[model samples]
Target: MTGKTTFEIFLATVPGLEAVLCDEVRHKGFRSPSVVPGGVTIRGGWPEVWRANLWVRGTSRVLARIDSFHVTHLAQLDHRARQVAWADILRPEVPFRVEATCATSRIYHAGAAAERITRAIHETIGAPHADNDDGVLVRARFDQNVCTLSVDTSGDLLHRRGHKEAVNRAPIRETMASLFLRQCGYSGQEPVVDPLCGSGTFILEAAEIAARLNPGRSRHFAFEKLATFDAEAWERMRTVKSERIPSVRFYGSDRDEGAVAMSEANAARAGITDFVTFARATISELQPPEGPVGLVIANPPYGTRIGDKKSLIPLYRALGQTLLARFSGWRVGIVTTESGLAHATGLPFLPPPAPVPHGGLRVTLFQTAPLP
Candidate 1:
């Protein structure tokens, strides 16, 4: 499809960071972006959908609202699904999976709905089916008996970024790291440091943002597999403008040599090795890079994810003291499940927003303005 028509484009993210994602989408030039419960929504066409999948970070996935109708029963759903112009979007040769959700609707059985949609696709589109969540994902949702159909444009989550072959334990997700960086008022203009960098997620995100690199540059998307995909147009979209040399730098340090190596390798894969620095150093050995201070963001080991709570007190205390003694003007953003650990940092944090669901645990980003 050409980029003229308008449609609903949904950008999903971790629940608590919807507002942050909304800001990013709006700032990234998405038209009329609005914050929803779990994500943000805008009205755009197929080209917008592809651009969103390519440029926007902090989103878990991108979905395009392909069609919708009112269906009260399984038969109605099946008939409506078959009538949809599937050939316009889905490929007859590609594999597909249908995921259904029902809420306060007469057709309350999601499984039955999914089966009906699957049969419809098989019968009308002549596409093979996949059991796992792979390739094209057709999302069918019923709310008050109003069924809406959407296609997952992003095959894998955006955080994967097609890089980072190695990782440390309980590493922060790239999506969450980008949102946390935005929460700390980072906009790719200032330097960023992560003393407890694990797999260098935050540092890499900061470096990419500063360098104006597209998050989807090295990755492929489900949209390319769809019948609606236009290869020539996509090539134009993939060609990003000049990658301006960023004036600022990103620094990351970890106590584990393996983590440092992992960060270095990941940075090299991302093609931003010149703008990033990774080293092995404990929190006490952490020192600010030369020049103006910026932001210090860390995903330290929380008790539930690593060790016991009591055993982590000294780590938090030491981190706080070292920051106070060395990095006075820099701001801090820490992701932790427990409030006590954040409070132990002794940084003047403003009131935090609601906790976000992460790895089956509720986590929050505690941030401070430029330190006094």
Candidate 2:
């Protein structure tokens, strides 16, 4: 595969958030973005793949769809997998790994499919293979005897962002945080406040967006090690910075002093300490910052993850009362697993999106117009 060879690139997202991620991809100017079952698909070449890894905030992984074919059994899978030009993508010196999943197919054994593909790579490209932990990942999905192979250009999950080293209990992932912000109509024009901030994922993501910092700037990607990678061009793409000082600041507060400290430290690592503020305060004590009536969003503790429902009801109630009373003209977004907890806020929420899985719980973002 050459740098200019156009092909299908998939942006994988949480199942329920596919449309939101599709909007982001379209906004970023990727060509022919279409929502698929588990993610969004767009057509692009190698540079677009790099940009997707470097720029997209809502996607968990960026996959280069290299090849696809019909296969009924393991023998056909092995033959077609070996027929792929693996040497064009995988460097012989680099280690690689294959992952396969089968659904409603004659080749129902994922392990056997993976083994055949692994052997194909070894025989064709001469690259060493590793287990779950290491290697450049090659993914195969078999559905109804049709198999599509993709290269996972993202080595680590995009949420890692290579900055946050500390987190509180049941903390939200950065990828989800960013998508939630976009769903809340945040475009970096207004300040963001997170009263229940745990390690400040939402606030940090907001600050970076406002400052126009690239989400993947501090991280490395699997694409950098591919045979098609051009070091000079990658550096040029990576170093092209247009960051600005944000006009408004982001704020986060938590009752736990340790959580507050972690948020502060995380902001520093993300290089947005100058644009974000952290404080220790209870839900009752939470108040909007002085300058702007912007967005107040939070991922508070729901009964399933932290405290019991009985104990958290009052906390939710206090959060709702505070926002309703003091945050007039400011929008609000609260994410929680329990409908009762969301209702407890009493923040005049509009209809919510479908619940998306997060940390083993299905959480929904309950949003509101400017609070009444």
Candidate 3:
């Protein structure tokens, strides 16, 4: 623990957004990172973890690499776990939890694996382990006979920013929204309109980003309780010089009254109510305030839950027509779980990008240029 240690920072991404997420990380100044199927790993320390949590717009969670070794059996796992210098990383006063997942490994029992790891920490390092309200979580990923250990620095998933009290059916996560926005080349410079905005996630994220607000500003991080926690350093890092007033570049709309109300409240809580305008409007009635060129990012219904496929086709067609008629010269980004549904839009859009796994479903982000 004396010399500088190489720690792995895990950046989780939506399935198709791995490349986009990787590009975002690199563009944000991360050095020499490797991308995996679901995420990317970068070499860094606690400071890097803090920076990722604050600045990474597309990542769902940021985990710190702790230790990794091959364990073919439970005894080997227990031995290796006990051998790890947990005391050097975790403080004795902070409570922690162990969550393990085993695949194709000799130690396939997840419950037993977790228990063994927890016991090792308690007996070897004198750390407090609990089943609930654990500030830190030890994640075990066992695959191909290799077991990797990571510490969860992000307590709640980054999408749960603790601001939204209400969410509509099939609500999009803030991380996914942010990723879609970035995929559309959103730089917080032009107007963004989400016609089918459910619960206002996309609009709210856009508004916050435009205002230069840190996504994790109002939340508490697990790293705060670590032994190496520096309160003063964290406070200085969180402060950014920006105006409190909202800009006029963000807008959202939904046909559901309740969804609109919830979005407005959520935006107000994030201090961007004056900048974001949410109204009850359908795709056919949607219109941008001033529209030469901007971005229209929307998460439309996939018709998997309540609506029939045939009836929903018209809605998609109408959306396509509306975008073609009123939003010419603008850029459009559409996210949906069904590619067939997206095709119904009938816009001269590019082929859907790689599908991203979300909430047990595969989602594709489709982009289109303004109609001429």
Candidate 4:
């Protein structure tokens, strides 16, 4: 497809962070973006889809809407699906898969819907269809009797930035970490500290942002397999050389020696070790990095995920007390599932935002102004 051709592109994000994702999209200079229930929508063509996958940080996936129509039954869906010019986007030699979901529609069988779409693609475009490990994904949703077809341009979830092999339990995804950093008003102009850094997601994400590195630089995208793909153009887009040397350094510390090692290794893999520091230190031993008062953000062990609820109270108390005593002049952002644990910190927090769903639990960012 030509870059001039316009189409709807959906930037999928976690439920509560749609606004934040939209803000990021808009700031990235994409055309008129609007917030929806689960994501943000913008109008563009194939290049925009590829660029979105390349530059945007908070989106979980980017879906390029192919077609949509109202259908009451399976026969109509099959007919309309066949009418779509799949060859324009999908290459016949590439393997593709269709996943379907039905809700409040007369055609209610998800498997049946997927089968029909698969048949349509096979018969019309001659593309090989498979159920396993296909690089191209077609998402068909039948909502309120209207079926919408979209192509998943991002093969892997955006958080898997092709780095960071080591992960601690209950680690925050890189996408959510970026959005939460944005929510805390972090502009990458100052230092960031994650006392409970698990595999250094926040510190690495902040480092990348400060350096203006493209999140999708190291990964391959599904769009590369499509007929619309321009290899030379993509090479030019990904290798634009826009990174800068950050003025401040990011810090991560954990009591576990293994976690400290994991963070160090992850930082080295991300090519930002020169701009980050990781060490083994408990929350009680937390100290601010000298030279600037920045943001101290931590995704501590929520009780449900790591331990008993009552047992974590003292941990929260100690974290709060240490920050209150020594980290004055620094802002704080804590991600937790329980309000009680957050309140135990005794920091004066601003009003909380909507809780974001993470790992089957709704987690909220409890943020505070610069500590006095």
lDDT of each: 0.89, 0.92, 0.82, 0.92
User: Taking the tens digit of each residue's C-alpha lDDT, what string does model 2 give over 182-296?
Assistant: 9999999999999989899999999999999999999999998898899999999999988999999999999999999999999889899899999999988877788878999
Model with the higher lDDT, candidate 1 or 4: 4
RMSD of each: 1.7, 1.5, 2.1, 1.5
Candidate 3 clashing pairs, residues 3+ apart or interchain? 16-356
Where in model 3 is the C-alpha error above 4 Å? 242-248, 305-307
Q: Which candidate has the highest lDDT of all?
A: 4
Residue 5 lDDT (model 2): 72
Could you tell me the lDDT of residue 131 within candidate 1? Answer: 68
C-alpha TM-score for every candidate: 0.97, 0.97, 0.93, 0.97
Model 2 shows how many backbone clashes? 0
TM-score of 2: 0.97
Model 3: lDDT equals: 0.82
**CA RMSD (A), model 3:** 2.1
Determine the backbone clash count of candidate 1. Answer: 0
